[model samples]
Target chain A: MESDQYYLMRTLKVDLGERSYPIFIGQGLLDQGLMAPYIKGKQVLIVTNETIAPLYLERLISSLPNSLTVDHVVLPDGEQYKNIDQINTIFDALLEKRHNRTTTLVALGGGVIGDMTGFAAACYQRGVDFIQVPTTLLSQVDSSVGGKTGVNHPKGKNMIGAFHQPQCVVIDTDVLNTLAERELSAGMAEVIKYGLIYDEAFLCYLEDHIDGLMGLQPDLLEQAIYRSCEVKAEVVAQDEREAGIRAWLNLGHTFGHAIEAEQGYGAWLHGEAVGAGTMMAADLSCRLGWISESDVKRVESILAAANLPIYPPEQMTSVQFKEHMAVDKKVLDGSIRLVLLKEIGKATVTADFPVELFEQTLSAGDKLGKFI
Target chain B: MESDQYYLMRTLKVDLGERSYPIFIGQGLLDQGLMAPYIKGKQVLIVTNETIAPLYLERLISSLPNSLTVDHVVLPDGEQYKNIDQINTIFDALLEKRHNRTTTLVALGGGVIGDMTGFAAACYQRGVDFIQVPTTLLSQVDSSVGGKTGVNHPKGKNMIGAFHQPQCVVIDTDVLNTLAERELSAGMAEVIKYGLIYDEAFLCYLEDHIDGLMGLQPDLLEQAIYRSCEVKAEVVAQDEREAGIRAWLNLGHTFGHAIEAEQGYGAWLHGEAVGAGTMMAADLSCRLGWISESDVKRVESILAAANLPIYPPEQMTSVQFKEHMAVDKKVLDGSIRLVLLKEIGKATVTADFPVELFEQTLSAGDKLGKFI
Candidate 1:
C-alpha cells in the first residue's frame, strides 16, 4: 500500500521562464531519485537544523548519486536563531569545505532551514543553485514553493532576504508523521489561506477535511498541500516580484507579522499569528460591508477547526501592531497597506480603507467577529 | 570654464531590459539635478563613509530636490569595515528613521562604501531602489557601473553579495581632486585593464596619455574614465550574471584576490593587487605562447606609468596564492579559472591552461615580465 502511494506522486512546475523549476509531491520522495536531476553540480551542501538532522539527514544523503560530494551544516532550530550570524555559519561551512560557485545547497528541514539555505545560496559567491527539501507542513505548503528566502531581523520578520528560487522542491508527505500537532495546525493556516484568497471550493474542501488533515490522513493532507501549492505557484508566476497580484499571498501576513514581531518571533508560530490575523482581516472586511458578519464567523470557524488561533494575543495592543506593521515590507510611503477580502475568495491590497475602522479592528480584541 | 566642463557630461545606458539603468559621467554631476529622476521614492538614505561624508555628503544633499526627505549614515572608511555588521548599521538607520519600501538608498563613496551600501540596499527589506554616486576614480569607471555589490568575508573577498543594479550611477570627476594619489593610481590599474582586455586602441590611448591621467588632468581623466566605463558597461550588458563574457572583466582578479586575501583585505587596495595580478596573468599568457614577452612588458610599462605595482607583495608565496585562489568565486568544481590575455587587447576565462606555467607565474614575483 505504501509503495502504491509512491506511484501516486504528483509534480507541479513554477513557470518563471528561465528560472522556472518543479515541485515534487509524494510519499518517500527522499528515496525516489527525484532530486538527482535538479541538482546542477557535483558538489552539494545540505543545510538543516539540529532538530531535523537526526530525523532525515542520512536518508537524504544516501539518496543522492555516489558521484556527488555532499556535506551538511546543522543549525540550531527556532526563529530567534535565524539571523546573520547563523547565515555566516553556512558561509563558513561552504568556505571551509571549499564548496565552489557550482555547489548546490539543499535545504533539508522546514521554513527556517529552507529560508536560510535558499538565502545562503542566493548570496554565496553571489548566487548558486539550491534545492528545497521541505520536511514540515508549513514549509511544504507555502514557504518552500515561493522564492522568498531570508532571515529575521531583531526588529522585523524577513527584513533581510532575496528573491532566489530553488532549482526544485522535494516535498515528501510522509515527513509530516513526525510533526508536532501545533505545527500541523500552523501549516493548516496557510493551506486555509489559499482557500480564503483564491478558491472558495478549496476552502469548502478544507472545511470538510479539516479533522482528517489534523489527524494526518495522508490522502487529505496531500490534496490540501497540492491545491495550496497550485494557488501559490499560480500567484507567484503572475507576480514573482510581488509588484501586483503576489501581494494577495500576504492576505493576513501584515497583521500576522505584527503579532509575531510584538510577542517576539517563535513566541507564536507564523501560521498561528496568520490564523488570528486572517480573522482580524475578515472582521475588517465585515466592517467595510464587503463581507457579512457571518462570513467573518465562517473564517473564524474554519481556522478554529484547523486548531489555529482566531484572535490576537490578549497582551498585544493596537499601538504595537501599528508600530510593527509600519515596518512591514508591504508598507509603502508610510501608509500600512493591507490585503483584505472583498468576498470569500476575492481580495485586494489597499491603503484606501478608512483609518477609524482599522483603528477599531486593532482594538477589537476578542470581539473581532461581532459587528457592534 | 567650470560650467562648460559640466556640458561635457557623457551618459551611457546598461541595456539590461527591465533592470536597465544609466551611467552619468561628468564634473559636478551632483549639482546638475541628474539624481532626481532616478530616485523612485520620497525618502533618501545617503550612505557614505566618514571620509566622503565630509567632502561630498552635504553637497549631495543640497543637490537633491528639497521636497524629498533625506537622511545620512556615516560609516568608518576602508575595506576592512565592509561586512555584515556595517550592513546592519545601514539597516538600523533605515528602520529607525521609518524608511518604507519606497525609500531609495544612495551609495556615496568609493568601492567599499558603494559595495556595502549597494549590498544593504539589495538585502534591506529584501531589496530596494538605490543610486550609486561613486566618488573614487576606480568606482566611477568600474564598480559603480556594474551591478555586482557585496562585502568581503574573513575567508574571501566579496564572499557574500547580490547582483543588484542601481537606478543610476552619478560620477563626478571633481571628487578625484580630493582622492589620494595611491588611490588615483589604483583607479588607473582598472583603466589600463579596459585597454588590455577589450580594446587595443584604448590600450594604446592609455599608453600615450598615461602621464596626463596620473596627474589627474581633467580632459585626459574624463576620456580615460569614459572609455573605461564604456567597456565595463558593454561587458556587463552582455553578461549581467557573470556566466559568460563578464568573467573577462576579472583579467587580473584571481591572482589579485589571492594577494588581497593573504595580506588581509585593505592591506593592499584592490586595484593595486589587480595591477600586479594582471602582470602575473600576462606572464602566464606569454608562457602559453598566446602573447609575446614584449607584450607582457607593455602591460608592465603601462601599469608602472600609472604608479601601480607590477609585482606581487614580497611575502606572498605560491602556496598561499594556491590556497586563496582555490576559494575564488571564479573557481568552478575546485579548478581555479583565470582570465588570461590572448593578445594585448583580448582576454579569455579558462581553467584549461598548463598547471606548471600557472605555478611558475605565481612564483614569478618581480620576474613577471621577463621570459625565463
Candidate 2:
C-alpha cells in the first residue's frame, strides 16, 4: 500500500430538475478551489462530532480561507446522537453566531454527522447550503454521496428528514486508517450489497481481494468507495427525494433499523446491524425460494469472512421485529415493503411476502447471536 | 350572506414530482372528516400559543379521533417568541412526550404561530408531517399555502426555515369572526397583496368592496380567500420552494419584515407593517422606473380604503432601514432582490436598484411618519 496515490473523482448529480448539485469524490478535494466558488457567503458551519472532531476538523477548517468565517459544533459521536435534539444543537450554535441563510453547513464526519448536519442546514433559516466531508467507510461508500439528510428517533432510524443536496462532497481515504477493525468489516457488508443488488462481477472483486480491502490498501479502498458512490449517486440522481424507485436504496435498512432500534442505538454499530439484517433478508429470500440456497450461502460466507455480523442477536423476537418494520419510512399504508434477493446480482421490493417466511426469518435472526 | 358560509377553504397543488400536498380551506375543515386519514395513528403535537390555546385548542383536540394520541404546548403569542429558545420548547415537548419521526405537528394560530410551528415541525426529528391550522387570514392566504415554515431572529424575520410540506391543512374560517377588528384589518394587508401582485382584477374587486370584506361578508370573503389561495397555490405549485421564481410571492415581505423586526415586533402588526411595506415597494418600483407613479397610487388607494397603513412610519432612517434589509433571506451575493411592478397585473424581481433611489424612498417614507 502506497502512502501517496492518485485517485479518480466522480460527481453524484442529484436530479432536482433545476436545483441540482454535484457530489465530487476524490482525494485532496478539500485543498481544491472548487468549494469557494460554489459556496455563496462568508459564514459556514463545519458540523462534526467527538470521534472525528480531533482528527479532521482542524485540517478541513484550515483548508478554508480566513474570509470563510467558519465554526463547528462537535456533537456526541455515533448513530445514537443522530436525532432532533442533537440537530437542534447545530441550530442553536448557528443562531447564537448569527449565521444567516447564506451560511453553509459542512458535514465533516461519517453518516451520523453528515445526516444530522445536512438536516440542520436543510431546515436552518428554511434552508442553507451544505457540503459533505464524509470520513468513515460506510458514509464514503454510500450514505455521504446522496442528497439524503436525516436524524434517527428512539422509535426508528432516519424516520424524519428532507431531500437536501450538498454543494459538494470531500471524501479523503486517509481517514479510513483510524476506523476500527469491526467498523471496516461492517462497511464491507454494504460494499458487498452493491455487487449483490447491481453487479455480480463487483462481488467477485470483494471476494478475491478481501484482505487488501481490510488492510488499509489505498488503491483498493479508493476503487471500492468510488464505485459504491457512483452506484448510489446514479440511483439518487434519478430520484432525488425517494418518491418511486429511490426507495430501493433501503435494501437492508428496513430490517437494519428494527434491529438497531430494538437493541437500543449504539448497541450494534449501524453497519454491523445492517450486515446482520442483510443476511437475514437473504435467508428469508431463500426460504421464499426467490433465490437458491446456494446464493444465500455465498452471501453468508462472504460476510462471515469479512467478520461482519450475519444474524440478529437473541431476544429480538419476530413479533416486535414485525411491528418495528411497519414504522420504517419506506413502509406505507401499514404494510411493510422490503427489498428481497432475486439472484446474486439483483433484488426487488415487495409488500407481498409470505407471512410464515417473514416470521421465520425474524426468529432466525433472533437465534443468530446464540449460534455465533 | 349565507349562514353556512366559510371564508378559507382552498387548496394548493405543488407539482414537485412527489413532495406535493393539497392545502384545504373552509370553516370546520378539521371536523369535516377530511383530516382523519392524514392524521391517523400518527403521534401528534398541537403547537399553539397562550392567546390561541383557550380560543381553539379544545375544538382542534376533539376533532381528532381516539385512534390518535395528542400532546399540546402553548407559548405566549408575538413575534418575540419566534427564536431558538422558543423553537427548543417544541423539541423539549417532543422528546419529553417520546414523539418520534412519524409524529405530526398541527400549527394552530396566526402567522407567528404558524411560522414557528412549521419551522419547529421542519426541524423536529429533522423533519416531520406538519399541518397548518392557520387561524389568521394572513397565514391562510400567504404562509399556510406555500409550505414555508420558519422563525425570526434578532437580525431578521423568517431568517431560518425549510420548505417542508404539510400532510394536510385544516383552515376554519369562522375563527376570523371572533378576531378583533385590528387583527382582521392587519390580516387584510396580505389579503390585498394577491390582488396587487398577480391579480389586478382582484385588486379592483377589493377597491369596489372594501366595506364588504371588512364587514365579514361571507360570499365575498369566501371568494377573496379562495382566489388568494388559488394564486398562491399556483405559484407554490410551480415553485414549491423559492429557488428561482417562486419568490415572487414575497412581494412585500422583504420590506415588511424589516419593519417588523426593527420595530421590536409587538410595535406593529405583521399585516399592518406589510401593508405599509407594499406601498413602499410600489413607490420604490416607480422611482426605479419599474412601474409608473399611477400604479403606485393605485396600490395606495386600495390599502388606504381598507384602513391599512399606506406609509412607513418615520422612525428609522435610511441607514437603519438598510441595516435591517442587509440580513433579509432574499438577499443573495450582497444584492437584494425586490419584487417590483411592470404594471397593475404584473411584477418582476430586480436586485439592481439604484442606491440613491432606495435611500430616497426611505426619505420619502420618512416625511410621512417619524420612523427614526
Candidate 3:
C-alpha cells in the first residue's frame, strides 16, 4: 500500500435528526486539524487513560488551535477502572479547572475512555458536547458510532448508561499499529459481526480477507473500519434510542456481558467475550432451526481466524450465565431476550426460543463449535 | 373551602414534543389510582427517603395495581445524603430486585428523591420510565414540571445531573399537612418565586394570600401549586434545555446555589436560600437601576411572610459567594451570568451586568433587605 493512499479519508454520517454527526476515517486525521469544526466551545478537556496519554495525548493537544483553552484528565487504564469513581475523577477535573457548560470533552483513548468520557459529557451540567477519538480497533469499529455511553455495575455490563451521541467520531487507523495482536483480534470480532448480522456480502468480504485484516494491512483495516461504521451509523439512525432494531446490534452482547460480569469486568476483553458469545448465539440459532450447522461453523471459523475465543471461561457455569443474563438490559420482566441469527446477515431479538436449547448451549462450552 | 371543592383535581402538561408529560395536582391524587395509566411496565420501584417512607410508602404501594410487582428502597433523608452513593444504592436495589428495562421507578418523596430517582431512571439501562410523586410543596410546584434531575457534587450543588423528564408528576396536596413548619416555609420560597419572575398578578395574589398559603389552606395551596406548575410548564416547554428563557426560571438560583454550597447542603433548605438569593438578586437589579427600593422591599416582605431568610448566612463572605457563583451552570466562558429582575414580574439572564453592583450585592449581607 502506498503512503499516499493511506491519507484518503472516508466520512459517514450517523443521521439522528438534530443529533446527527459524522465519523471521519483516515490515517493521521488526528493531526490534520479536523476536530476544530466539531468542538462547540473554546474550552476542550481531553480525557485519556495512562497508556494512551504518553503515546497520542500530546499529538492531539498540540494539533488544536492555540486560542482554545485545552486541558486533560488521565484516568487509570482498563475495564476495571470504568466505574463511577473514575467517572467522578473526570468530573472533578472539569470542576476544578472550572470548565463551564460550553466546554467540550474530547475522549482520547479506546472504548473504556470513550464510554467514560461520553457518560461524563452526558451528565456534566446535564449534558455537554464531546468528540470521540477512538484509538483501538474495537472502539473504531463498534463503540465509536453508537451513542451508548456508560459504566458497568458489578452485577451487569453497561447496566448504568445513557443514549448520548457524540459531536463527531474521529477514527485514526494508524493508532492500531501500536495495538497488541490480541486487541486487534478483539476488534475483528465486531468487524465480523457486521457481516453475520446485517450483510452477507460483507461477511464474504471479511472471510476472503480475514488474514490481511488481522495482519493490520492499512487498506483492509480502513475498509473494515469504514464498513463497520457505515452499518452501525445506518442501524443507529433507524433506532437512536434502542427502542427497536438497534437491539440487533447486541447480537452477542447479552451473552458477552454475562461472561464479563461473571468473571469480573476486566478478566476478558469486551470483544473477546463477544467473540465467544457470538458462537453461543449461533449455536442456539442453529438449535432453533433458524440456521444450519454449516453456518455455525462459518461463524466459528471467522472468529477463530482472528484468534478470538469461541467459548466462555472454563470456571463459568450455566447457572452463572443465567444469573448474570437475568439482569441484562435486553431482559423484559423475567424473560431473557437473545439476539439470534435468522441466517448469516439477518438477526432478530427474541425471547421465544425454547429453554432447553438455551440451557444446552450454555452447557456446551468447548463443544459449542461442534455440529452434534 | 367546601369539602367537595377539595376533590377537584387539576392536570397540566409539560409539552416537550414527544417527551411531554402531565402534572396531576389534587388533594388526594396519590391514593386515587392516577399514576397507573402513566407507568409503562409491570415492575415498579418506589424510591423514597426515610422521613417519608413511614408516612406514605405503604399508601403508595397499595395504590398501585395488584398485577404489578412493587418494591421500595428507603434512602436516608436530607440534602447531605443526596450524592452518588445514595444513587448507587438505588441502582443496587433495582439490580438486586432484577428490575428490567420495562420497569418504572416512582420517586415518592421531595425534590431530593425526585432528582435522584429521575436521574437513576435516566441512566438505568440508558433510560427507563419514572413517575414523580412529589410529596413536598416545593417539588410539586417546581421540580415536577421541569425535567431537570440530578444528585449534588460536593464542589457544587446539583453539579452532577441530567435532563430526564418523568412519565408523569403526581402531586398529592394532602401530604403537605404532614410537612414540618420549616419545610412548608421552604416550599413557599419557590411559590413566591413564580410570582416574582413571570406573573405580577400572581405576585399580588401571593402577597394577598401569603398567610393562607403558608397556613396550608387547601384552596389557596392547591391554586398556588397549580399556577406555579402552569408557569413552570410553559417556561420549560418554551426552552426545555435552559438554552434561553428557561434560565429565567432560575431567577435566584445562581446566588442560592452559592448559599447552599458555602453553608454546606441541607443547612438551609433550597427555598430558604433562594429566598435570600432572590433578595440579593433584587438588590443587584436595584443597584443596576432596573428596579426600585420599594420593589426590593416588596420582595423582602413576601419572603419574610413565608418565614424564609432574606439574607445570606451570617458567616458567608463575599469571596465565598464569588467562588461558589463562579461554578454556576449559567456561567459562560469566564463570565458569571445571573437571572435577575428587570422589574417586579419580569426576569432576564445576563452576563453583561455591571461588576460593581454584583460586588456590592455580595458584600451587602444582612443589609441586603434594607435598601439605601
Q: Model 1 Cα displacement at B245 (Å)?
A: 1.4
lDDT of 2 by residue, A1-372 (tens): 124745566565655566666666666665554576677888888888888889877877777777888878898987777777787788778867767678889888888888888888887767788988788888888777667788765655675677677887777777888888888887787888888887888889888988898897877887887778777777777776565566666777788888888888888988888888888778878888888878888988888888987888777788878777776666654577888778887878888988888887877777754321
lDDT of 2 by residue, B30-144 (tens): 5565677777346888999888899888978887877788999998888778876777788778766667667888888887888888877776645677887888878777778
Please provide, for model 1 over A69-148, each residue's C-alpha lDDT reduced to its tens digit, 9 standing for 90 to 100.
99999999998899989999999999999898889999999899999999999999889999999988999999998799
Name the runs in model 3 displaced over 4 angstroms.
A1-6, A366-372, B1-6, B366-370
Classify candidate 3 by CAPRI docking class: high
> Which parts of model 1 are misplaced by more than 4 Å?
A1-6, A366-372, B1-6, B366-372
Model 3, B331-354: lDDT tens digits are 898889999999988999889987
The 0-to-1 C-alpha lDDT of every candidate, in the order given, reads 0.89, 0.77, 0.89
DockQ for all candidate structures vs. native: 0.83, 0.36, 0.85
After superposing all C-alphas onto the true structure, candidate 1 shows an RMSD in angstroms of: 2.0
Name the weakest run of 10 consecutive residues (lDDT summed) in model 1 chain B: B363-372
TM-score of chain B of 1: 0.97
Q: Between which residue pairs do clashes occur in model 3?
A: none
Which DockQ-derived CAPRI band holds candidate 2?
A: acceptable
lDDT of 1 at B199: 100
